[model samples]
Each structure stands twice: as structure tokens, then as C-alpha cells.
Target: MTLRSGAVTALLTATLIASTAATAASTPAAPRGEGAGVLRVSTSTPLTTAARLQAAGFDLVESRIGTDLLVVGDAAVRSRLGRMGYRVTVQQTAPTTERPVSTGRTNGIAAAAATFYGGYLTADEYVQHLSDVAAAHPDLAVTRDVGDSWRKTQGLATGNDLVAICLTKLQPGDCQLTPTSTKPRFLLIGAVHARELSATELSNRFVDLLANGYGTDAEVTSLLDSTEVWVVPVGNPDGREIVEQGTTSPYLQRKNANNSLGACAVPPTSSNQHGVDLNRNFTWKWGGTGTSTNPCDQTFRGSSAGSEPETVALSQLMTTLYPDQRGPLATDAAPLTTPGYMLTLHSYANMHVIPWGDTTTKAPNDAGLRSAAFRASYYNGYQTGQPGQILYTVTGSTDDYLYGERGVAASTMEVGPNSGSCTGFTPAYSCQDGFWTANKPAMMYLAKAARAPYQLSLGPTTTSVTAPTTTVTAGTTFTLTATGNDNAYGTSGVGKPTAQTVNAGRYFVDTAPWNGGTAVAMTANDGSWNSTSEVAKATVPTAGLTAGKHQLWVQTRDSSGNWGPATSAFVTVG
Candidate 1:
């Protein structure tokens, strides 16, 4: 379902535009648990003759953009409508959600209630939590829906709708997006499974700490002011309700309450009773590898890519905010998200994962991703590496989708719900702070990601082809024209850089030269924007003709801001 598009014209006759202009034009299902490709489009094309376009089999993209939107419906119908001049983007239909299976020690049943009551923050509560904080500041707090989850059956058991929330710095346009760049977007999601109470607790505390510290903590204040942090405290409300029903027993159902296998696994003590693992249902691998079909296994592949409403809802939300890997949203926007990073909180594992969860192999950008993961790992005191490399080969993981399939920079910070084996639902509250403290570093790391997207693009890109005369006539300017690899508002790329300037990413000419006294040498710079590089040097003449023997030399630099090996040539006197 992954979609791609380009910047396009705006339409006054707008209905809905398809997600992408695939050769086959029609409304598509919400990418469901599949990778992010669905762009919802509605019927109606504007300006162009719909019939004329359709007969040619050309997808008449009537929306402002040429690409598609994640639409929900038959792709052919949507395309035909676009040809008829209806402005369409992807429409919402057939979305999905994932299931969870986290079997860990909780304090005995009697104490479980207190922990859930004190620690867990429901989606509604999350909103209230943020609102209360916003109420306190009013100036700093604002709410926005980055995207909506797939529509689903009313919680069959509790009959309640599911909810996800975003807690970030408010800005113009849609709350789902920031200005392509200028600020990094850090997403912190928790409670993908309802039973894991502490996951939500961590998020609740985060809101308070960040908002309250806008003035006290220098580091915290800087992050709140600059970074756009999205926090979804409770992702699966329906799944959580199931756990609530077993208040005393602490039932162990993993998947959302689809009841795919008999509707209920009363006193869920093993995978033989429950159905699929929601976390394993994402579209990236889409049953390609690491999926369970036994229905009773801990990880079950759904009917198709996105079978659950919960999975569908989250995918649509993520896709809209981030485009596909291929290219940009408009002539000016990034081709895709630069380094879209995310952190999904889980329990019972003292490990941090990178990518390629389906297999044991390493991903292409493992080093870079590892660098970012290390930032959080260092804080959590958790080990760093891939699932195969560290914990075991895990397939159908969200971290894999965020990094590989959907192009997000993501990692898993698995928190222990209980420190010891028997402590299950009733871990001591004293341990709460320790868990919170470990995750705080990772939270801070996420906040930093939102600060300017590492500004992969900064530079003194201006340079002048100059002579070594060491003197320029008065009023002479270099006529500098600056340019670099990364263009803002475009796809997220660290571009190319050297040790020039991490902030400005620039290169310049020496205002002063060797002036015949120093070691026959002149130095030039290469602006390594994001990484490191060497500097370049050229040779000067200690003795030459009477006074005017000029010389020509070539100097070069690399993306790492490294200078090139120098060579020289002779010039004749005037």
C-alpha cells in the first residue's frame, strides 16, 4: 500500500484525491497492517474531461498533487472518477490494528489493581492529562490529531471506540505535520497493548515533566520549545478493556478483541488460547516472513495485510504525515521523511532493537541507526543491536516497519513490567521511578530528534575561483553563491558534509595568504555538513620571477569536510 506523489495544483472542486497515481487507479483499503502506501481518494475529477482520461487508462489525478492519497475503496472506481474531473485524495475505508502478547510477571492479583490504577493512563486520560497541563500553561500546550486510527467494530466486549493522542508543540496548518523541516518530529507511543499499565504511566508523567520544566530545567526547556513530540499513551483501548474485565485474574489476551479465535481466551495463560500478535501484524513483512498462522501462536498473521481496525488507523495516521521513500510531496517538499524517528514502549525485555526484525541480518543504515539507538540505549542501560543480533529473530515488528518499510527512524525500548519473574502484575511502586528514569534519557533523545531534524542541510556553500596574489583590489567581492546537497522542505537526507560547520555547514576562502614567508602553502576548506571530512592545501612559491610569476593550483574537498591531496602548476609573469 506504500504510496508516492509530487507537488501539484490545488482544486476548487475537491472531493478526494487518491493516495498515489499508480497505473491502476481506484480507491484502496486503508493500508491496514501493511506498509504505508494507501492514500484515501474520493470520487470527482476537476478541469480535465473524466471520460477522455479514463478511456486512455490514464489516472486523472484531479487533486492539487500529482501523486495519490491513501484512499479506501476500489482503486479503479476512484481513478475513473478522477478522470471525470473530481478532485480526489485517498479515502478512508478498510483499515486495521495490531494485537499484543506481553506475558510477564505482575504483582499478585490483589495489588495489580493499584498498579493499574496508579500507573496506567488511558487514551481519554492522556488527553485529559495533556489538557490539564495545557490548562496550566495555556500558552505552551495545544492539541492536534496527527491522523486517525482505522474505524472498527465497537469494542464488542466494552463497546468503546479506540483512541490515540499526540502531545507536541502546536503549529499552523494540520497538527499531523511540521514544516517538512526546521524541527525534527519525535513520536513516543505506548500502550499498543492495554494490559501493560506502566507504559501509559510513563507517558502521563512525561507530559507533566516537560510542560512544568519549561523554565526550570535548561535542557528540558530547550527541548519543549524546539521539538514537536507526539505521545500516544494508550494505543489499543479495546485490548486494554479486555484486560480490565479480568481485573482480579489479570487475563493474558494479546490481540485486539476480534475474538478471531472464539472471541475470548478467558484467563489467557498461553498462546494456545489467544489469537495473533498485533505488533506482529504490520504490513511491512505482510506474512512474507516471521508470522504465525496457528491462530493460537503468539504472533498470528491476520486475514491479509491490514485486517485489524487498530492497525489500519495507525497506518493511515503515519502515512499521511510521512510520504513514501521514492520522492517529494511537492516541488519543494522532501522526497520522503529525512530521519523520521520513533520509540514504541514495550515491557518485559531489557533490550533495544534497530531493524530487519524479520531476519537476523543487519540493515543498510545499521551504523547510522545504531548511533541514534545508542543515544537511547545509553540512557536505558539496555543493550543495543538488532532483534536477531540482541534478543532473537523477531518478525512483524513495528520497529522494522518504522525503519525499513515506512522509512521512519525507529527503535524499541522494551521496559520490564516486573523486575523479577514472580513479581508480574505487582512490581513495587518504588521500581516505577527506576523504570521511568531509564526511559527518561530515551525520551530526551526523542525530544532532541525534533530539534531541526539534525538540520542535515547547513553550509557556507559559497566559493570563489581565486588567485594566490594574497591581495584583492579594493571594493572587490567574491560574488559567493552558496549551495549544498540537502534542500530543506525536501525528503529527509543528511546530505553530504565535512568538518566545516555542523550548524551553518559552510566553506570559505582564506582572507589572508602565506605572503612569501610561511611554508609555500595555502589552505582551503570543505564544508562537511553532517559528517567528517579532510581539508585541502596547495603549494606556494618561496622564490619566483622578479615579482609577477603567477601559479595555478587545484584544491578539492569531500562530503566529510576532508581536504584533498594537493597538486600544483606554474604560471608565467605578466
Candidate 2:
């Protein structure tokens, strides 16, 4: 499911030649949920290959820059591609069945009308669910119609409105679109590309879980009390309607139904062709590499940046809801001064991708971004990094736009298996439960992180040094004790933090003319310094001590790899 390559090759050759060389394999049901095999074409120029395949109608699943282009396609499509002189291989054969075994929900009798379809919800059902939750838990749940989708604004029969559900202990202006607020905020977007059924489903489940967890679950209760979570369960309603129309087999729809660019030039017929690729319609790096000029291409970049109403609305909402959290340009990282979190969910890739999708050059906040993403991958075990590194360089992507433009700590969660009976653009309903379970912890962690995403807040610190008056005998061993606290490894207020919660911490014995001293970590007499309390003690051996001033410095690192301010004890060993 997680593929990484390190080969280097010519960009031009990799792009033009690798398109046909890319192989699509059928998948067999595997216990690990790798539903089908993937077709891979090795390419150094992943951007070119990915774009070419997208234009050619192949679902460009993934791109391992130095290795190969992994796409999703069937036998007939592979045969056609093979005839085009590209190498073809049966990477994996799919099992006889590729559908989910169960619906994964026990809805009362009333659930039937909304659950008319096999495993997915009707557009109406999605809308009603939000309303129902708002009505039931008015205190903690509220719904806002951010804007109408393109189709809805244009009065198309397939149009559906865009909505967001906010779940927190509600207060005046708690979920309002504002740049400043008391609580840290998190935005979870789902189904930007309507065909990714699981994306929407998982978002829905998250909203329900949060709404239903109030008072009963202490952790959830604490999160709700402190953090504001906004869930856009469905981002592209028009495209979702088109996808819902396919009952026999899931529709292979990738773009919105915004047919303004003319006919659907790729595959699946003219009548079925829809709109721009919402993911590529953002304003940042709008028309760079990894996008298509052809309107029907899966990665179409729209006529102009922010052209689509869905794109416009989402961008506007972000600007209004979150003040610029980072500075401009790729050099700036999310600011610790005003940090917020945003995660846009997609399906089938199983990746936790950070920003700078347009290039591999590290983002200004690279350390913080990577730290947050790496921590998020703890539960699901997905590979985490920028698309340019893990997958392929993309422009105008949702994550890059949010992070690049507003300095928000934004990431994309490519949920579920990359290819399998339980994977693909849309996996079976039964597989929904697994994705939800795996991501539950990941989401909970993000909620906790929203609090101090940029800065590592330290707890009260205490320091002890051997010998009074800053003087000690030259031959005497000197003891230094430091203790601090942080919330990175545990939920801020829900339960007791323990050694298991802390990521890492250290004690440094700083000698005069000290650049940070290189030394072994200090030990705790009673295992004191850990996630729970972050305490450590170091004793400088008399053998290494000289007749000079020395200091003991201690700091604690949070789960995000951010170290809190250092605490120190001064001493002079003479």
C-alpha cells in the first residue's frame, strides 16, 4: 500500500515513455485489504507521467517519483495502453468479489429511506442527517450551509448544497467564520471528488462520533470543551449526485459536474462527463505541473484559478475562519503564534501528505508540518510527506493552497487501501468500519494538536543544582535536576499523561563556550522524565569536570517533535 522509490532518471524520458510503460494490475482479495494489484510504470519524471496518464483517461493512483507510476485500470484499458507501445503487466488480479461485506451500520427503520442504496447515502440523506443531528444536539451541534455547489447555483437537477457541521460545546461565535476565536479550530473536508465514497462516509462518521460522544466519553468531552471542529462531510454535492446515480457498479467519476469546458473528453461517455477537477481548481500554483489543459482530464486545472464556486467558497471560508497562520511564500511554515489545523480527506492512496505539492523544496515550516503529519500517521501507519516526495508534484491542490496562502497547518489524508477488493475510488460499505476505526485515533490526535500546533507550551519547570553559591569542589560530582510538562503526547485535559505519552526529551550539560553540548541523555532516578511529567537528571562525573563554569540545560519534546523552552541550572565547578 505504501510505495517509495529512490531512483533518478531523465524527467523528459520518464514522462513521455513511462506513460505507456506504467502497468495496471488486477487485485485479489488480501487479508491486509490491498484489494487489487496496481499497474506501475517506472518514471523519474513523475509529474509528466502522472499528467499524461490523467489526460489519457487512466486513474493515476500514485507516483513514486524515482520508481514508477501506479495507476488503476482494467484489462481492456490495459490492452489498449499496451497496444500504444507501453509495457503492460498484470500487477495484481482482483478477487471475484470487490464489494464490502456489510453496510457497517445498524439504522433503525427510519434509516432505510436514507439508506436506500447499498452502502452509500443519498444526497438528500446527507442533508437530512446534518439537520437531524443539529436538532437532536443543539447545544453541541450546529449546521451551516457554507454555499451551494456549482450545479445548485446553476439550478441543475443534480445540484446539491455544500454544508458543514460544527461539533463542540457551543457558545456564541463558537463556530462562526472568524479570524480569531478563543478555541483552536480544526476543519475536516470530505468528498471533494464525489466518487471517493469512503471519504464522505468517514467524515459523516466522525461528525456522528463527536456529536454522540459528548458527556459519555471523557476524552471526547474534553476535546469538545476545548477545540472547535468543523466537518464538511460533503464538499462536492453535484458530483456526488452523479456518482450516486450509478447503482449497478460505482461510477468512475473524478471531477465535478461543471461541464463548462465542453464534452467529457476522456472515457465513460459524453452524457456522463461533468466538470473541473475540484482539487486542481485552487488559486495557488493554479496552472503549474501535474495538471491538465484538457477539460475532461481528471486533473483539469479549471479555466482560471478559483474559477469553480466550490473552490471559491471553500477558499473564502478558510480565509474568513482562519487568519493567516503562516507568512506568504513557500518559505513560511505554520506560525506558532496562531496555529490552526485543516485536513482534506481523499480515498484509495493511504497517504498523509503535507504541503509544497508543487515542489520538493522544503516548506518554511517544514519541520513543524512533517512533525504534525508524522504524528498523525501513528494510528493508520500511512507514509507521510509532501506529494512531490511521496507521490508526485501537484499544483493548485487543496493542501498546498491552504498552507501556501494562509499559513494554515494543512494536510491531505488519503484514507483506506490503495488498491484492493476493499479499496479503490470507492470501497464496499462494509470496509467503511475499518477505515473509521483506523482513523479515529488519528483524528482525535489532530483535535488535541489544534490547541498549540505552532508552539510547544511547557509546563511549570523546576531546576536543582548541587553546591551553593554557584561553586563546587573540582573533584566532586555535580548533580542537576530538571522537570517540565507538555501536552503533545496526551490529550490535554482528559487523562493523566504518562511516560508512554512523551515522544523524547534530554538533558544537556553545557560547558563554557557552549554551542549546544553533545552528550548522552540524562536518566531519571525514579523514571521521572517521561510523557507524564518530562523530568530528567544528569550527574557530571568528576573526571570530565574542569575548573570552569558549567550549566545544566533540560528541555522536553512534544509529539510534534517541537521542543519546549529550555530550563537551566547554573553552577561553577572550581
Among these predicted structures, which one has the highest lDDT?
2
User: Could you estimate the TM-score for every candidate?
Assistant: 0.55, 0.71
Worst lDDT 10-window in candidate 2: 1-10
lDDT of 2 by residue, 449-489 (tens): 67655453332222232323557888877665555444333
Q: For residues 236-338, write the lDDT of model 1, one tens digit per residue.
A: 6555544533322333344565655544333343223354466767776767544556554435666677667777656665664554542222112222226
Q: Tell me how candidate 1 scores on lDDT.
A: 0.45
lDDT of each: 0.45, 0.65
Model 1, 401: alpha-carbon shift in Å? 1.7
- List the candidate 1 regions with Cα displacement exceeding 4 Å: 1-124, 144-152, 155-157, 161-164, 177-182, 261-264, 272-275, 326-337, 417-426, 450-574
CA shift at 476, candidate 2, in angstroms?
42
TM-score of candidate 1 versus the correct structure, residues matched by position: 0.55
